[model samples]
Target: MSPSPSSRFRQQLIVAPAVLGLALVAACSNSSSSTGGGGGGSATLAGDCAEYQPYAGHSGTTVTMFASILSPESDSLQQSWAKFSSCTGIKISYEGSNDFESQLPVRVNGGQAPDLAIIPQPGLLAQMVKTGQVKKPDATTVANENKWSPVWKTYGSVDGVFYAAPMSANMKSLVWYSPSAFKKAGYQVPTTWADLMKLSDTIAKSGTNGSKPWCGGIGSGTATGWPATDWLEEVVLGGQGGDVYDQWVSHKIKFSDPQITGAMQTVANWMQNPAWVNGGFGDVKSIATTTFQDAGGPILTGKCWMLQQASFYEAQWPKGTKVGPDGDVYAFHLPAVNPAIPNPVEGGGEFVTAFSDRPEVRAVQDYLSTAAWADSRIKVPNATGWVSANQGVDKSLYTDPIDQLSAAELTDPTATFRFDASDMMPAAVGSGQEWKSLTAWFAEGQSIQQTARDIDSAWPQ
Candidate 1:
């Protein structure tokens, strides 16, 4: 039996943080204990800022934001609201991502919609637009804030109207390794694709002594093949560059294109080999945590040498593990596959969506766009691994060294920061067909040609 995409997403969600729920609710309640004296007991409207204007005015309204229940990354949104409330006098509430997705359609159909929402799934957002359930965000609202990354703006748009602004971004092109193991083995960090393969080959040939080189796990309950897809995407983007990658994601190019085929071949060659993945590639289908926790295992237990995953993996490292004078884990930029096609980084972002149309909802949005809101809520006491989307906040606010690295990577012009291709695409393609197709390739030993054909056939053409 294989894990389903929904179950995988759920598993990933569970391990991640849902800290936003409590913070959002607290921001809405008019208790001086939480709010303190700021913005005259409310967030100031856009006109008040002079730099930006409020989207709409519902001076005393309360809006509920639907977010992912498993998102620890949402603390930034809560902080934004707290600042919004202090600057303007609006209150905001937030719900889990799944809860909001399930309830949004019902509420919109029932005339009980929230003024705003922040759906993690782009397809759902598109559907809302199709049904006239969402309003296009005013361009001016996000003009000053580079909240909409070029790629996201395209996917989140329908009929040329942008619906949401990207709140925070994730980095996926990171390969974490046990520095100690690498040093002991006399292995140097690979700077190019050829060197990367050579490194993997060396690790594979070397019998597992204290460290295995790869922590490949495709198991996440329902979303079984996602890890495989990540491998495919990273390799393809690194080898083919952004243009070809974009074409495939947008259905402009076939999944079976030579570029994509080569990418899958690379993954198959690496993963199918005996030494590349600990417990063998066969074990990928059964390992839990999507091998996320395992990524740190090689270094932590000295069993594996490296794990390629997003920066979020830093949070999953065993608490109290020591890496050096610093913590136990660290991440390196995914090495460039070719100098021609820069190594593109993969990530996810959160947005604020509205389910209501009151003045307060507008006030909350306006408040969120301010610096004070970003500083207080985002710089939460224990949250060391989060970043704010608002470009105005201080970089020092990001306490986690890994997060700081992710932030730095995001700003590089040579690197293309693309959302997880599967996550950004329509759910039918991303979660349904893509998951099934890729997992079948890995688990059932399906042909690369067949896998690519299957994916193209399943695409929403």
Candidate 2:
């Protein structure tokens, strides 16, 4: 569906020179707790209300939200708040994405939490619900206005109550490459797992003529092993199919299950081979800034043929480079890893959460539910490559062709889209043991069996 007039106009405003100053203000203020739900009134349970016409003229309320590091997505959030304020006359406070995760708990425990929050990790939201620090949506009221997908809704549920609303989602099982290079090398896109491995082998063999086949970087500080974990999960999903991966993430299956072992063994075999990755794969930290930078380096310099990453990687490309003929950039769905399983995509979504029990907090939630607000707030011109999770928004909002393609892939019904398995696991397994163990395996030559055991040990009891 096409974006509304207000959304289109807001997109123009965000790109105007005058609006640049407001961009900083919008991102910083809208993301914090200084904006909505400030006063004292019992939070109302708005049951199954299809459209919330917030009590008119509620100017004193504040809605604070937190998100990850700023990028194109930040522009969308800001525009959303701007539209929300215009519609309901409410103010919003915003903050950096990383700040909220650490700061929210301390403040909530101290009784100074914001009314609303957008957490990137579901495990954190789960903790909030468990501690009674957050409130469940009035199901009758929420169900009336918004219908959520089973995948999105389930992530925010704890004991049958929904605590958060999912915003935007991206497809992760994609490998981006330069079409020009592919054409020059006479390579054909492979559709199945066996064919994909053969393609990689062909690219590797071509490297003898001085072209590297793949661009693999495992560095992101503190999150160093994430890239590798993506490879592992992709392979596992392909090798054992989604059902087994789902069981593993939900803790129904052990990390050391035979299927998982085989997946890890596949990764070990690939990394151990000198041709598959660069020399620094074993030494870099996953979260290190350089890791992201390196992933794009090979492509920019025409050294490597492909880089497998999520849609967000487009924002990280070097300044002034465009995709296609004008720019050497393009992406394809990560080829099926196993011929036996259906080709499903893996990725994650961002959600908005609340810590306040005030009436105005619901107003902010209602505002976010509107397509007008989402269209205006999320279509940042500078962030040309981000795909939105909101259904029926204008595809024209995305300027980059690759972003457009990714968005189309996400909406395909035949494709199975699941959250990144590692990220979906409980924090101990998702962030602590699993991340550290994988990095250790790469850098220190830690045994694969021990790494699997370490991950298994960290699973929540």
Candidate 3:
């Protein structure tokens, strides 16, 4: 089976599927009480469903959604629509599976497609659109999409026709560190890529609070080398800037081009350096064997001080873990090569698309595209590490400091936000060779030249 991005941003593998059904009860506060589009929501349930009035009149309807998002986040997503389900009498049956990426294609091809799917990769979404199975969005959804950044609409579109709406977003351009450790060590977060390098060197010389400067693992089952890809991506986007990065992704430049190899070398200098990495694990080779899920665990024991990962990593910490500048763990923006380069924050998110165009499904799709739904989703109480690019969302509702930081970076008008390159690239190279070759570079000591050459050769012929 083709590897699905189901494990790209989320690399944790599961033996039993993390499937879930909607409880369908919700209460949350939002500044946008007016449901901007769609029809009325269910009026039968408790709490304020006024904002969901646009989705109303579908009381007897049910819309089944399939996606890669798992347990806790799935719970928040299901709860997000509780009020809508209550007010509109719509039953939103949601199922989550790590195999969603691989299974979605089979389901669609086998004519077992769900009412909707949360496509985490734009490339996969493009494939679904090409199959002629995914339905185009309704006018309301198109209008709601118009409210987002053009970059987002472009991702949800193929050949300039809109088919899906952007869902939740996670920031990848982050370096996670124990805040208390940093403070105790008197190490300030770096503000530029050069400063970041210097900080790494400084920490390698003496370690952080008596622990190694970094901990890393690329293991995500079949997606072993993806974490390294994220490293190279941000380095390219920040070091070479967006235009060059875009050219590389589109194949205007070969994967073996000097620019890309240079980025890979940079990753080696940091992550593969024995002195700087495998802090809590073992030698550099340990990274290949370490699961991304367990890579950051050493930070808790003070064996590893920092790990570069996405904002969603907040959920990786054991329950009751504190996250903030003054808390147990927090993240700082991975800086650009220089202040002159616009911060190119690499991010990942889902596009909500449907296989059937039932009125209720259309209503759900239209509602998802609206800011009201974005607000509702983000307003899931006690849910940490949630961020949305929707301009209409109230950022103040983000009680988690990391969520605030991520949202500020994601929604910043001046920032150059790029979708994950591997997710957007053709799968032959992105999921196959790039992953395989990068892991060799880390585990087998393959040189940047060889890794780049291999991946370049693997690009769809």
Global lDDT scores for all candidate models: 0.58, 0.60, 0.77
* Best-performing candidate as measured by TM-score: 3
TM-score of candidate 1 versus the correct structure, residues matched by position:
0.78
Off by over 4 Å in 2: 1-56, 86-89, 97-107, 110-112, 138-141, 144-147, 208-211, 279-289, 324-327, 395-399
Tens-digit lDDT string for candidate 1 (1-461): 10111122233332222223343333333422333222223332333332222422333445666544344434434644453443333456555443344556677788877677656556656667767767655544456356434665655566677766655556778787766666767888787778877888787678455344676666554445666777778887787877887787787877888888988888777766555665332343333334433445555766666777766555556656543313456667777676676557766555555544445554455455445555665466655444554556677777667778877776666676666667666656776678788878766778999998888887765
Residue-wise lDDT of candidate 2 within 108-217, one digit each (tens)? 77887667766556666676676688876544335623544566677666666778776666667777787777777788776776776688787777675445666666
On lDDT, the stronger of 1 and 2 is: 2
Off by over 4 Å in 1: 1-9, 12-62, 69-92, 97-115, 121-123, 138-140, 144-152, 209-211, 221-224, 279-284, 287-295, 322-327, 369-372, 388-390
Q: Show where candidate 3 strays beyond 4 Å.
A: 1-47, 208-210
Ranking of all candidate structures by their TM-score, best first: 3, 2, 1
